[model samples]
Target: MAGKSGKAFDFSLFRRLITYTNPYRLTFYFVAFSAILLAALSIVNPYLLKQVIDKTITPKNGDLLVYYITLMLVFLVVDVISQFLFIYFANWLGQEVIRDIRVKLFKHMLGFKKQYYDKSAVGRLVTRAVSDIETIASIFSQGLFMIISDLLKMLAILGYMAYQSWELTLLVFAVLPLIVYATRVFQKKMKAAFEEVRTQVSNLNSFVQERITGMKIVQLFTREETEYANFKKINEKHKKGWIKTVWYNSIFFPIAEMASSIVIGLIVWYGGLKAAQVDGMTLGLVIEFIQLSQILFRPLRQIADKFNTLQMGMVAANRVFAVLDTQSVIEDNGEEELIHVKGDISFDNVRFSYIPGEEVLKGISLEVKSGDTVAIVGATGAGKSTIINLLSRFYEIDSGVIAIDHTDIKTIKLKSLRDHIAVVLQDVFLFADTILNNITLNNPNISQDKVEQAAREIGIHDFITSLPGGYNYNVKERGVMLSSGQRQLISFLRAYVSNPEILVLDEATSSIDSHSEQLIQDATDKITKDRTSIVIAHRLATIKNADKIIVMDQGTIVEQGSHNELLEITDGYYRNLYEVQFASATTTE
Candidate 1:
């Protein structure tokens, strides 16, 4: 959702954006120099026209006339060169500024707490990073620098006209109040229209992104016609938002054109009358004033249009700055470096809540010994996944102490802590890249030999070689090119290559076929040998060989022991859960 704030023109936002150009100050100065030169060169053509009419052509002086014409040609060449410099340098500054800001914004997002993304829309964040940054680029490339050049040119033309004939100059400016009033009103209406258009664009992006991601559900439910109708309604609203801007432009430009033409007409008429009645007022001066009149009023009309680019850029800058100002980052205050951990984990009086007053884990305590394989089984929403989330420090508990080897986890550097652990989530995410690169994640330390060796050790090397491209095969966006089971196997190879001291498998085999499950179980056996392992599973059959099993219900541990030991408890929670959640898996196995 995009919203509008502040006045029509926000000077504070403009000031903030200008500071981004500090790194490119030299290029900005060159652009400023070019604008000044172009503005100074613009007045020469009209002044030379007066000289030709009064001093050369009127006196029948052929030699002087040729000289003035040649001088005009020289000025024309310089003007073209100055315009080129201004355009090139202005665009360069704009592009460089946006590049830096985009990188900074992305880096900031990477450090944000998981909670921030949990509440934010992917499409809205995408729009801010891409479309909004492009809009800000227009401020320098087409808005601010161009406005300055036009304004300076207008001032030069006005000064020359006043010097030539004060009477006609005053008359031309009589229409100023009317043009200014119309421009102010146009700006107010267009600002609102542009804000609405941006909001609709973000909405359209979010809707399309979500629908495409969940397209299987839509098709399975046979909601194609209904979805199409909904899209049309959103598209219609987007169309209407743009149409409102066009309507305002359609009305404003015509009025500005008419006003400019009327001013030129009045200048010609009044200047002619003065030449006949007043002393030192000649026909040539009247003609020169008409040319000057056109130059002055043209920029006035162009300025109104350029103002729209400026206003839109300001609005976009406001949105980007808001994201940068967010204080939801998980502070990395840990000074302790975790070089080699012993893999012992402890939870003491841990109390946590995703939302206030809705606690997910309540004062639970547990200890995991070194090299032990612990399986946690629980009903849906019974705080099973929450344990993994806390162990990885993806979230901070409301009140508790979680430690590794007797040191509080809060004292360990985030990078050092996470670097030693690997998580293979049920919903595996793979980038659109080669399979080998996905496994190694392009880490230089993990060579091709190491990756291939790890894949073989995990028993997926033959499966990879069976594919058309072997490890070079491209897994399209989100690994859509691969089957669900194949994707799961790739995730296993990825975690294996990392060679983490601690391994976490969260329902890794829940959605796989029996063959894939067997492969995963074999890989799990090899990888978890003499290493810490935590498995959260709904299917009890997979965790039967785990060293210990912890049964959870309502955010509390209800049963804890080995598989046979837990079954020995008469009518226990683990027994009931196994009968209800794992019976199908057991029969299939």
Candidate 2:
């Protein structure tokens, strides 16, 4: 049953492919016409040969023989040109269709939420985006056009043979059922073999990519030989999969050939007897029947193989559809834009969970005025980041409502709400582009001066200007080209470039050196002076100037007050953190 489902390729994906090719419908129509012309012209050749042998050659009519021969040569030229035209158009259409599908798939993947990446393997996604799409292209280029051409030629040949000698045609096709039955069985086994091949290849690809990405760690730990053995084991598994695939393909062609040969032999022997018994059976007629029999059965063998190729394509289509069919749990609800946002934020009895029955935040209530600075301080896993995530609507809250500017976030457009906010995380992510481009990613209209101002505010402009390429210096992936402090400074500039009303600093300075951290601290002060800021920090010293600090432990807030007020709470978590920092400062002095 599962095998049947695999064969039941989604026609919608094919339909999508057709839609892409629709713009070039003229090319396809010409291709189809060219194929039909070629098929019609092929039928003429046999009749011409029959005439030359039965009439011209036997009767010694040199003029008629010459005329037939000239006609045959003309058809040969026309037919070759038509075949070339069909192939050229088919290839052209196939390439364009694949290009469109690839672009669409890439764009779709981009729109997916962060949660999508959390559950999907990069290797698997990359394979679907590349190799699977190529399979679709191959099917259209070879499989689709071949099916059309072969079926037409097969039908025309069979029809002609029946017209000439039905009795011999039926006798020759008697073993067709057995061939088809064998093909059906082989197809099932081949499907399994190919599916296993795909799986093993995906695993091998995933393992190799992961190992290469982490090669430094592997070599540092001195596990090269161990990793080599593991890789060899995976490669061996892939080899076994291909071996089974080869076996199925190997068996299918021989059985098809044997069946074809047996049928043709029977036709030859029977036809010879028929010619001897009937005076109407000419030698020319008998040879034509023999020649036509080969033509008919040859395509039968090829048709079965093409069917297998089509089946393999169907199997690949299932995987491609599986990716396109993924329903994003987090959707924009067609609300990605709104006119104005006041930036007043509130979480009223909000609740959430990463997984069912394991709530991370429970009935948390918090409100911040339009321009107030609210700092959340806690140990690790205290739901500090969760609060900001909810406000940003990255994940849907389990219960209760989160509102921005007194409007429920669900009703307001997601893009508009998020457009008013900025988040600078501890681990900064930079693209392999220039520094200016990274800073102004969300707002490309910003001038070079504006970008430099933002960077200088964070105190990284001087250092960046000293680089060989200056502002155009290409940062390596994940900003590996720069130190941790430099990356954080650029991240700060990125957030400030947006000029957001609501700014979020989630451990933004935790990885930076003390000097750079102070520079970032000064920039944060200036940027958040008139904005609503939510700082989720591990370092309590940084939030001392914050308007209000809400101290949390586990998933709930344990204290909420000014810095002095929280510090006076003798045995509180906040008080303990402050005392440790004070003692450390005195000891260093």
Candidate 3:
């Protein structure tokens, strides 16, 4: 799928697009019906002109000439109405399809796991959602309508010409085969150019979004000039892409125009010579032939342009379908919900790795009894966070049996499993919304009183009250308006307010200063009174109160005991870690 040439149109993607069009089937039918009616009206106009020249004007019948003129006007009015109907439905269908596609794309994007985001760029995804969808919409409204209307008109003209004089029709149409051949050549180049232009535009959008989002970093480093230089490179690339497309279009229309002109010249010379015979062509017939030349060649050129747009739309459709087709690596099991959870957690011979042949968690055995606070400490990259991730089922373990209350977590529904637990990471994320919303994000059903109570318990209520709007104050993106200590305090409140049976704090207090850390630790001890708690922290002082401390190194547990037990043991990882911290604390003071 990645290496697909996209030279041939992807019929499957078109089929999917057409499925979305099914809801607007009646509108599409009306559009097609109106196109055919308009073509019939076109045929009637030329024939009416022929009649006025032969049966009315040539015979000096002034009354018949007036009647023909009146009839032509009526045909023109009907053609206008039919064209209006066609345009209305075509535009409506295009908008409707775009709306549906946007919803589906957004839903699919939301379902993607973190790994998908880790690999794919935010710019590339945004391009697929916005720019690609827009390009396809343009193709629908203009390109699709032109294809239908022109095809019908071309067919009507060709049938009328064949009936009038096959020889002359064939003679004039000598350039048509050339037109089709030329169109195919132009279509390939134009399609390639359009795809290149879309790609370049997508890159530019990504650059803009990244630059704007990171404007602070750029400004702080005084790298505005360098950033602008980088932006100019991408902007120039986009310009070159559009210029290439224009160059191809420039050649295409001129060649088509020249061919049409040559065909018209041939019609004038040859039609006149043929009219010298007794059964010669009528004046009306010559005029009709001239009109037919326009009817045929004009649509031929339009068809060429429509084909180019359709080809470009196909490229976008392929990309959109690629996103919809991606499978989520983790899914919930359809099992009974565990509403009443006992928070006893156990890992039976757990062995896991993110990549093959490089294990991050070795075979180990451990258990946390219900209503116990267990602390996990390790050197960097020692799989402390990996264990927490598995417990939460963010990623499936390669080989392990992780059970809560002796029930394997994989056997329980994902929603039920996650609902029973809560986590607060050191680096917390907050939306650009009120503090009230961020605290109650986990459970909106929770009352405002409860939110305030949780904040007060975490010792941040007084601080929030000091702000102008208190809980209603807006947090900037990522809670940037607040200090780091404040962000962690809010996150702690959010996690504690959930009141889950199991709580996991992944270095939750590591980012704060000594004053905030002490406040958070006091709250942590109170919150863990009757709940299952797992703490992953580097600071020994934070977890000294835990019932048990498991010290890890290189993906394997090396020491497990109470804080004092491990600290008293010689040559233990915990003892060495504690001594270093103790010495560092004295040195700092």
| Candidate number of the best TM-score | 1
lDDT, candidate 1, residue 445? 93
lDDT (Cα atoms) of all candidates against the true structure: 0.88, 0.79, 0.84
lDDT at residue 336 of model 2 (Cα atoms): 38
Summing lDDT over every window of 10 consecutive residues in candidate 3, give the lowest-scoring window.
1-10
Across 1-589, the per-residue lDDT of candidate 3 in tens digits comes to: 4216645455566667888889889887887788888778778988999899999988999999999999999988998888888888888888899889989999888767665777787888999998788767766777777687888898988998999988779877798888888888887777677778777877888899888888999999999999999999999999999898788789888888988888888787778777766788877788778888887888888888787788777777767777888885467764868788879999998998877788999986789989989999989999999888899887777787999999988898888888889898888999998898888974659888998888777677898888769999999888989988788888888888888999999998877888888778877887788999999999998898899999888888888989999988988889989899999999999
lDDT of candidate 2 over 190-210, digit per residue (tens)? 767777777787788888888
Write down the TM-score of every candidate: 0.97, 0.90, 0.91
Shift in Å, residue 578, candidate 2: 3.2
Q: After the best TM-score superposition of candidate 2, give how far the Cα of residue 268 lies from its true spot, in angstroms.
A: 4.0
Model 1, range 1-589, lDDT digits (tens) per residue? 1235536677777888899999888999999888888888877888889889989887989999999999999999988888988998899899999998999999999988888889998888999899999999999999999999988998888887788778887887888778889988988888888888888988899889989989999999999999999999999999999999999999989999998888888977887777788585777787788887788778889887888887788778888988998988877889888878889988999999999999999888998998999999988998998998888888889998999888888988889888988998999999999999999999999998898999889899999999989999999899999988899999989998898888899999999888999999899898888999999997798899999999989898888999999988889999887777666756868
**Model 1 worst lDDT window (10 residues):** 1-10
RMSD of each: 1.7, 3.0, 2.7
Between candidates 2 and 3, name the one with more favorable TM-score: 3
Which portions of model 1 show Cα errors greater than 4 Å?
A: 1-4, 278-280, 581-589
Candidate 3 ranges beyond 4 A from true positions: 55-60, 219-226, 275-279, 442-444, 447-449
